[model samples]
Every structure is written in structure tokens, then in C-alpha cells.
Target: MSPGASPWVLASPDVREETAMHDHRRIGRELDLFDTDPLIGAGLPYWLPDGGAVRHALEEYIRTAERRAGYRHVYSPVLGKRELYEISGHWSHYSDDMFPPMDVGGEQVVLRPSLCPHHALIYRSRSHSYRELPLRMAELGGMYRSELSGVLGGLTRVRAIQLNDAHIFCTLDQVTDEAHAALEMIGRAYEALGIAPSRHRLSLPGPGGKYVAAPGMWERATALLTDVLDRSGLPYEAAEGEAAFYGPKIDIQVADGAGRESTLSTVQIDFHQPEQFDLHYIGADGVKHRPVMVHRSIIGSVERAVAHLIEAHGGAFPAWLAPVQVAVLPVSDAESEHAEAFARRCREQDLRAEVAEAERGSLGARIRQARLVPYQAVIGPKEAVDGEVALRLRDGRRPDPLPVGEALARIGVLVSSHSTALWDDGDGA
Candidate 1:
């Protein structure tokens, strides 16, 4: 049987159902988004063309947002020397979660588990004055970890993850304001995606020896975060012992359609790492002082974010983000030229459109297949002669036949505006 015909390919009910909606894993396969192969590795997934399209769209969106927010995006190596993690204290604290190092010419190198240490090195590469404080460096970096085989699921948990990661080097006095700004950016992202604003979680270090910072620094950082939350007018719940070994963080928890909540974004204040890395900037008094490091992930991981979007929207993506926005289906071989021409016009207008040839299937079968697409433009004898297309929305609404130019214009508006509505007709059906 084909991969799509296999029932075992679908995720368990617990993995993706809230009502009768489709499972993300099933939709992923049906839509040709991504797939896993046991021969390569258990947790690794290869993204198909459709999946790659969605990811590209998402990455562009976030990169634009970060640029507007004054972040300087950069690229770094995926693997680093063992001594690099040792300087960042990850070797001592997070060694269990990291992949074992490989020997290379008498040196040990490992895949980076996080982008923090590399970012620290970037900050320390140049001397900075007080005026250059709050340097925001961002990267959509790939990381590898030794995840348990049993815990790996589609996109949510994996051994190899791509992080939407960044670090900010700022003075101590700028902590509260920077945290507040991070929260505001997260709010804007969730709002754009049409996801409900998730509740805030202020995670603090517990009495366990897992925490690495001095007791005094932990208290100050935790108190500063609490103040930031209070001043931002955002309600939050504080949790003890949930903080990372190096810092206290605020986690944004979002729920999927199945009511399963996961941390999708975070802002952390780290006093320990800067001290360990000896990151410094010249103060106004002509003295050197340690810079406070702020770690943040607006959407966390690209893979996980795409998975959440798949489940949250049931794969009916917004017009701007849809892999294939419109399918042009010709009723018969006679209309195939008209259909192809119409598709070409739509593509020229910057719309994602494709022509479904009539040679492979009947009109009815073609329509059934096009149902997976957001919009279908049918060109029959009447439509071909009249220079119009019968627009059939996936939501089952059949609007009146529209002129080819008019239909393309309207779709261009919707795509440019990123409207969530299937149609911009007065009724918004």
C-alpha cells in the first residue's frame, strides 16, 4: 500500500484530536508536508516541498519582524569545540541532554545544543561602550540533542531542532524594559497568527542544587522579572524549580486544539553566563562591568511552531501562508488551455496557483481532489467562452462566476493583506 493509504501513518487520538478534526501527522502526509524514515534516524524528518513552502513563509515573517525590532540576525556554526560549552558551563550542567562529542584531529567537537554560548562569543569579540548596550543578536539556528526515542513525536519533540533563538547584551538597569519589550513582541506574533494570548509563567529556581548562579544573583534576577511582569499588566503564575540552571525565565504556554499546553516562547535573564564568559562593556565611569545576558525565543523552534500551526488551524492556512492558494481545474481537454492561462495569470499576480489537467481524471474526481486546496477555479465550456471562472471555495460556498481579471485582483488583495477569511466577499464566507 502507498504511504497515504496506510492507517498506521496517522497519529494516535491522543496526539491530535480535540473534536473530529484531522490529526497533524495525517494531514502532513496527505498534504505532502514531511515524513520520517527509520533508515536515516528515528527522530529526523525530511520536509517535502509543501512543508518547505510553509516553513519558508514562516521564517520570512519572523525575520522581518525581528529586523523591524532592531535585531541583527547572524549565522553561526552548528558544531563547536567541547571547550566552548565548557566555558559556557553547559558541559557541567547540561551534559546529559547534549550529544557526545566526536574526536577530530586530537580535538573533541560536538553539535551545539543551544545558540547561547556561540552568541556570547560574538558579543565578546569586540569591545563596547555604554552607548552600545542592548545589542540584539538573533539567529534561526539548528541544534542537536540526545532525546529519548520514546519521547520523539511529529515536530514537537525531536533529537534535531531548529531554534528561533536570540541573545541581548544589556546593562543591569535595562533588564525590566528589555523583558517588557520581549513580551510585547511575543504578543504581536500570537496576535498575527490568530492564536489566543497564552498565560505567562514566571519560572524561578528552586532549592535544588541544579541551579548554578549565586543565591544573591538568582534573587535579584527573579525579583526583576516579577517586577517586569507586574509593570507590563500581564497576569502570571510563578513556578518554582522550573528555571534553567543558569537563569530565571518567563515562558509562554499555548494550547493546541486538543487542550495540550506547551511552552512556545520564552524570555530569560542570565547573570551567571555573562560572569562565566567574562562579557564586559565600558561603563560611563571609565570602568569595565559585566553585561547582563537576556536569552529569548519568540516562536521557540520552527519545526514545533509549524506543527502547532498545523494542529491549530487544521491545515487551512491563511491566504498568504497557504502552500497552494488556488487550483485551476479544467472541465475537459478542450478547456485545458484556458485553465493553464488562468493559472499563469494568477501566478503572475504573486498568487500560488496550479492547473489540474483534465487528462488524468474526470471533472468530478478533479473537483474532489481540489477540495484539499483553499480555492478551486473551474473552467468549463460556458466559463471559457465567457472569460470567467466558477469559483468554488473549499468551505463549500460557490460564489457567482467572476471575471478572470477580477478574481485574480481580489485574490491578490487577500494574499497581500494576509487575511484569514477564505473569501473577501461582503459576507466573508
Candidate 2:
């Protein structure tokens, strides 16, 4: 074993193939990704610079994905009036899930548990048109909810989180198509992240139980989703009563490092909220009709997604998502200038690259350190004196020589693709 390889890294096969949660925790702490600052309180993570980059990348990825699918991004506050929750019916259904209110002036304010109410208000801001049948609004929304300390686990479960939330207001006639689009978007997201479809599950809570609001609506919505899933040929299993209080949902679950299951994406149909909020739009007939609302999170929350990614990739991360994709080392002081120049070229190609100062340690020692962080270490040597680099990948790969310019161009293309193609493992059969 390599000197730095820990038992945790060897005994765990997922870490070598794909990161599991336990592997993620070990790697996260070692990489200084996030920390629980006891002084800062519990269930909250203070993301270090490197960890923050991972979080930001997640947000960026979701934002771009939603935008391409006709979703507009928006922002909502972390706090709202107590009445807001009541109006949205969240208080009655999920009172226990929420934090207690804060006395403000003469009224009570509660930390927002979810962004649905705020997004609903946005929908009510003006009279919508049938031509704008599907108005999709999204937010990398920060929300807070009180939780017992025992339940918090690194970034997986947090007191505060930035939910990749979106609300789609579409006519009842547009429901199936809009839902199809949303589910497609979710599949594409998981695919891009290299998450096997077998790791993806679409959960639907079966009927014959209480709280299936508006029987007709529930039936229609469930049928639509079932049809979509079947037509898409995506493998999924239904879990009865797994639907949200408002409607049935397509829950996308992925296996974490430790072989545990967790929701990574979701698409929910809401028939209750629109009626409760009296949300409507002018139809082609100039008559008012209630628009159905669809809620989705391709990657549920940045904090949780980061946790999943860390575990999924065992902190090694894919080339595109790696915090430091490439680390350049100058074998000798004479190579420092050349190494710096080459690193800049890599950066210009949109690759995350950095130069490790020779002052830090021996070139070999730094090379090993780079592997610990699991970066592809590029060493500058005599052969690199002519603007070339001795490239090495993380997994103990042999070195190769390439011109600085050509390497940068290739790296840029690879990173920009942001994903690799592999056979769809469709939910582990």
C-alpha cells in the first residue's frame, strides 16, 4: 500500500470504485472540506475554501441544468411570517418539522422551512397567460429548520441548506408534458454526475391510505407519472405513502458510500397548493383556470449533494468536479517559473490547476501529498524545461510527457464535457 493509504481507503471497495458515505467522511476531514465548529453551534457546516468550491460547483451545475430546461432562477428570504406557513398549509401538516417562531414586533416569524410558499407568492404576483402556460422558477434557496443534534451528519443533514428548488406553473393540459420534461431533466442530471440509473429510484406512495388530496387530481397525476416513467423505460420502485402531503412524487434515491440509500433528486406533483393559494391564469378562452404546480429538485440541496458527491467519488471526484484538478510541481528551483507558466495555461483552458512551491517540500513528497488530495500531479522536470509536463493521474498511473499547450487544450475539453459516457446501470435491476 502507498504510505498514505489508510485502512479505511483499502478495506472499503467503494472508495476505490465509488465513494460511500463512510469513505466520504474520512476523505472529507482529510481534505479539509467541511468542519463542525462547536463554537459555531451544531448541525451546521463551515465549508472551508475547498469545500465551498464543491458546493458552488453543485449550485452552478443545477442552475445551468434548470436554465436549459426553461427554468428561471429566483431568490427567497430565509425567514418568513408565521402566517405564510399556515397559508401554505405547511404548519398544519408539518408543524413538527418546522422550527418554532421568533417574536418580531407584534407578530411571529419562523425560519422558512421550504421555499414553496415564497415561490407561490411569486406566481400570484401577476395575472399569467395561457401562452406562458409553463412558467418555471427556480432558486438555490437557503432554508432553515430546527433539528435534533443526533440527526445531523456532516453535510448530509444540516440545520441550514440551499435547496435546488423550482416551481413550475402549467395548465392542467400541460401537466404531463411538463412533468415529462422535469423527469427527463432529472435523469440527465444523474447521468452527467455518473450516477448509475440503477442508483436512481422513482418512489410513488400508493393510494388506499389517508391524505390523497383531491382523488381525481391524485389519480390523474399518478397515472401521468407512471406513464412517463414507463415510457422513459426508467427502472423505479413504488413505496406507498411515500408521496408528499400535497401529491405523489418521483423520488430519486442514490446509494451512498456505505450502501445506504438517500434522496438525491425529486419531482413532485402538487394539486392542493394552487387551490389553497387560489393560483390561476387566464386561459385561451379568457376564463380563469387554476394552474397545476410541479415541484422539483434535480439535486435536492447543495449541502446534501456535496455530501453525496464526496461519498460517491470517495473525494477523488471526477476531473471536472475536482477542487484542484491538477497540481503542478517544480522538481527544482530552476523549474519554478516554467511550472507557474504551465499552470496558468491549464487555468486558461478552464481546468482547475495550481502550482506547489518547491519551498513546501521535496518534489516527491509533494507528489504524494497531491495524491492524498487525489489530484493529478504534473511534475516539471528537465524534459518539461521545453514547456512540457510529466503528467500523472491519481490511482498510481505512470507519467507521460505532453506539450503544455496541447495538454491544456485536451484537459479543457475533458473538463468542459463535465461527464463520461457509460452504460446505464438502470437502478441495479
Which prediction has the highest lDDT against the true structure? 1
Residue-level lDDT of model 2, residues 1-429, one tens digit each, is: 221222233335645455434565667888989888889888888888888777777677778878888888888788899998888888877778789999999999998989999999989999899998799999988898788888877887788888999999998777778877878887777767766533444455555533644778778778877876787777677676567776788877666654556677888888888988899999989899999998988888888787777766667776667788788887878788787877787777666778888899997888877873334545556656566766676766544676777666656666666654211123421
Question: Per-model C-alpha lDDT, please?
Answer: 0.85, 0.75
Highest TM-score model number: 1
TM-score for candidate 1: 0.89
- Stretches of candidate 2 exceeding 4 Å from the true structure: 1-21, 197-213, 372-381, 396-400, 421-429
Backbone clash pairs for candidate 2 read 19-311, 19-312, 20-257, 21-257, 21-258, 197-427, 198-426, 198-427, 198-428, 206-240
The TM-score values for the models, in the order shown, are 0.89, 0.88
Native-vs-model 2 lDDT? 0.75
Error of 1 at 123 (Å): 1.4
